[model samples]
Target: MVYSHSQVQLYKQCELRYAYKYIDRIPVPAEASLHLALGTSVHGALEFLYKEVQRLKVPSKESILEEYHSIRNEQITKIQEENKRSQLDQQQVADFAHMGVEYINWYYSTYHPFDQSIVMSTEEKVFPKLDDDIKFRWQIDRIDTQDDTFTIVDYKTSKRYPKDTDETFKDQINLYGRAIKQNYGSKFKKLIAKIVYLHLRNEIAREVTDEEMEKTRIKYSSIIQEIIKKTQRRSNGDKEAFKPVQWYRCDSCPFKMICPLFAHNYIHDEAVNLDDMKPTTIKAVIDEMAQMAYEIKRLKEQKDSYAKILGNYAAEKGYKRLYGNENKVIIGKSENYSPLPEKKNELESKLASENMLDDVVDIDRFKLTKKFKEHELDYDQYQDLVKKSVSITAQRPSKLKEKEIDEYMDIIGEE
Candidate 1:
């Protein structure tokens, strides 16, 4: 399948989301937001601005703003008509329009006269074939030629300006540079990438090194290969081939109604009648589990508060145990030992000299368990470690309502 930078990013963001969008071909209604509209309008205006520059004509601020408004208005109308559920209101649209004007104005004033470099093309499409089967199709906002060097310029309407060390954007732009280099290597000796953050009125420009280009190629190609592997596994009926990764963006994900991580949440929210949630069904179980989890969390919070007070009182009185009429409360304390930060090396060296380092150092239980299963360790050694370190934790489940539990527990009695 053909890929774009966005598709690669989507797969990186959440593999399940990529599978839903690409593999399953699930159709989620497009969400039109003011942010997207503003970005599009701004990009369109900038494309117009640079295209004019390419033709030896620099548009005035008024002209650019006019173009921006035209595009913004058209986009707003389209969103309002097509996306009836869109949350963007008139005030937000106007504000975003004004923000777009500000960005264009700042960008124009910062680099006026438009003679810094020769504009080779605006909104240039570059298709770089990775292999016989893999190809990426993307568009650069603008391309400039100056001093035998090609500069890939990308505009950003994002509020947050990325740092110099932000490799996500760096990798994306470098990929663009690589595409340009692959397509037109004979024309230029050097390549540069310029990311213009319009909202923040900032620009980050860097030379696209050959090392970065190669790294970008390998990194993205590996991601594509991973996608291929997951796709193949999915075709073979592996249900968990594409795991959903939770992030802040999951709250706004369009696939929440169907995504395994979040589908349960919407099951109740989207249900219509009592019949939709039968008591014997998984939906009922899910709802009950949710309620139990919330109740447990609340009870834990209260338990923690009481425990804190009891702990403080026990410490103040130097008491190990407090007696009630029938039930007794026990307060226990234990400290874990670790080498001091300043003298850890000295302590480790001393332990090593005495050949007692292994005795003191904690075993990685996970690795040990793996070794045990692989029969890498002798049964006696495994059993000794297990007896020394392993302990079973048992927990019992209970359902308790807020009204059934007492508001407070008396740990100390009056003298």
Candidate 2:
């Protein structure tokens, strides 16, 4: 079995989305977002900077920006050529490209001369196998060493930097640190992690405790075991074991057009009969809809009727979430990120400095960071180089065939 943190997260997000991409291997027709395209460029530029530093050379800001723009242009062109219809428009593409320029320029300005740690390696891939049949694989963006200390620096290009307690990003870096110890026999006295938010032009550092490092290995192994069990169940004839997870983020999902939840995108023409579902279920569904209609009528609410009718149909059917032409149906509660006290204070201070505390429509962290930099020390020349960002999707995972699971188990001496 081959798995990674992202693969596990995908299973958590929606098993059905995982099934569509991995099990069915459907070709997703979604366009690449600006966040991802610019991130790709920033990562490459950082790698180039380290490689140059490793050779006892300093990379100028212009050269680094040049490399970033070059990579961004190449990536956008390749995305367009491959996805002629799905690729982003020229303005959208330019906006993303602009962000990469700012991110790289800021990154180079902050961390030149490589004083933080001795660069051990960049873009390193680690494969840690627990047994003959199971292996966990992931790539570390860059790993740096100082004396006996090992620091895994994960780069981010987001408008909002993650809190120190953000589980997803924190666990990912910790997983890398533990993997190094497990697979490479790295015995560093200090294990640290730094999330260098390129957008903010600052770094968040944490010393990884022994307890945290050890737990990462155990938790990661548990995730892998779970995936194996799920795959075994599927092979044993659990046809619908993998079902779609109904989350509101479906609008951004590449598989949304093909998801069965939407109904219209699914091309099946099979007829349904009342005889198939239990009489009780059919009656319950009708009764629920009838009750909702009555309530809507009694309340004299015209537009709210559809929500009752459609939402009940979704809830009563136990379908994950409801969505089609427009995702008007509400399946469950929703969530969004809220700034913690520290973030709020920091943002308020900056807003106060600019005398726009009340004029704040919605705080754009990217623009705010740029504004502070320009006010403190002018860099209007780099104004055109600024960029925007959102969260990026995970990369595809490695595949292992189900037919080989048994043989692989035998080779690993499993019963």
- Give all candidates' CA lDDT scores: 0.81, 0.72
Candidate 1 global CA lDDT score: 0.81
Worst 10 residues of 2 by lDDT: 263-272
lDDT of 1 by residue, 80-187 (tens): 877776565668777887899899889889999889899999899888766678888988899999988999999999899767686789888877887898888999
Residue clash pairs of candidate 2 = 99-387
lDDT of 2: 0.72
Each model's Cα RMSD: 10.1, 22.8
Task: Write one digit per residue (lDDT tens) for candidate 2, span 313-363.
Answer: 877788767778865455764588565776998887887899987876566
